[model samples]
Target: MFMTTDVTDLAAVRAEHVRHIATTLRDVRGPLIPILHAVQEDLGHVDQADVPVIADVLNLSVAEVHGVVTFYRDFRRAPGGRTTVRVCQAEACQAVGAEALGEHAKRRTGVGFGATTSDGAVTLDEVFCLGNCALGPAVQVGDRLHGRVTPARLDALLGEAR
Candidate 1:
């Protein structure tokens, strides 16, 4: 059974919801990652409230489940903004002023990485790579990717997202 809780309701992660997710995927080999992904996909973030429920259902300790959640950058502990802006911070991107661009983004949006804007319009994230190494300073605005991005280009992207 899918969670009846609203998708945007991070705190609505009920034990039954986690139980359903865990039970459905339990038979799979090494099910932790997949289950976590499913939960995030469904709930926007892996609420800490659901960790113990998942652990109990999967017969694992809460620490194990929490460890996996914390270890992976893909899992968010809080609700993300309506839009996600990921800046490539890998060596290649950094070589081309990505660091400066990242700073500009944070300053412009008034939020650090892993934080959402005050208006809830955007979430700033740092990504190690976007595989567009040839075009350093790559960035992704929602589903679309751009390369060789400057601070101005990032501003346009954020504007569009807003």
Candidate 2:
């Protein structure tokens, strides 16, 4: 069976999680990044409502916490898909047809970079490098990295993700 939480109840629960994370890590040196990372790890993304709670714990302004969250691409402002598909776009990968593969992925997924699929199956992202230059045209599906991927291969991968 499926259960639905009221929006306000969800918000309250998220706030409590954020507050707990912030308070737990506030004493560490340069706590903001760790706190943010922990929040994202535990709750998917850093909700806008989390900023003030974190700021208050760390004795900073909401603007300060918000700045850290917004400045980093690694930090997602909203929930992403269950699977993250990252295509390397560095010079090496680009030299080996990454651009075309990326285009194909966008067309197939019907979502642009930084956006998740409507069904929340996959999120497509472009990364500068995955450190697999020797095998250019690398694509990372979640934590696993693949190299020398063709469009057909990518389709297979997406099919698995779906």
Candidate 3:
């Protein structure tokens, strides 16, 4: 049900949205995080073009805004797929074949970590932990978490995602 914006109009629209969000939330204490979150919530990702607009509204330098965006793993620099798949790469998960699972996912999805599939159906990502150590090799698809995932299980999950 997600629709993409035309490339030609994307920048202008993105700037407008970022400016509005920053302006609305400017008065909030420690407003940067909330403004960034709101921008991402509405625009799917924080475009580079948005950095200046946010900085201008918050009375911050472009570097300050850009630094925050890049520092947080939660913020996407570009649009992601409709579904996000996060595989835990923490010690617990890696101890139990999570690395192999992650590799399989990359090969199957034809995209590396933080990259969306060509068709925009899925985005593959790696996470440090999912707090399911008892159940290592955890994979989060969209909002649902699955533990003890195997290659076949991951394939099935990706199929469902697409």
What are the runs in model 2 whose C-alpha is more than 4 Å off?
Answer: 1-5
The number of the candidate with the highest lDDT is: 2
Residues 27-95, model 3: lDDT tens digits: 989999999899988988998889999999988999999999999999998889999999999999999
Report the number of the highest-TM-score candidate: 2
Q: What is the lDDT of residue 7 in candidate 1?
A: 60
lDDT of 1: 0.90
Cα lDDT for residue 151, candidate 2: 94
> What are the Cα lDDT values of the candidates?
0.90, 0.93, 0.93
Evaluated at residue 149, the lDDT of candidate 3 is 94
lDDT of 2 by residue, 9-105 (tens): 9899989989999899988999999999999999988889899999999999999888999999989989999999999988999999999999999
Superposed by TM-score, candidate 3 places the C-alpha of residue 59 at a distance from the truth, in angstroms, of: 0.8
| TM-score against native, each model | 0.86, 0.93, 0.88
Relative to the unseen true structure, what is the Cα RMSD of model 2? 2.2
Pairwise lDDT winner, candidates 2 and 3: 2
| Clash count, one per candidate | 0, 0, 0
Worst 10 residues of 3 by lDDT: 8-17
The pairs that clash in candidate 1 are none
lDDT of 3 at 150: 89
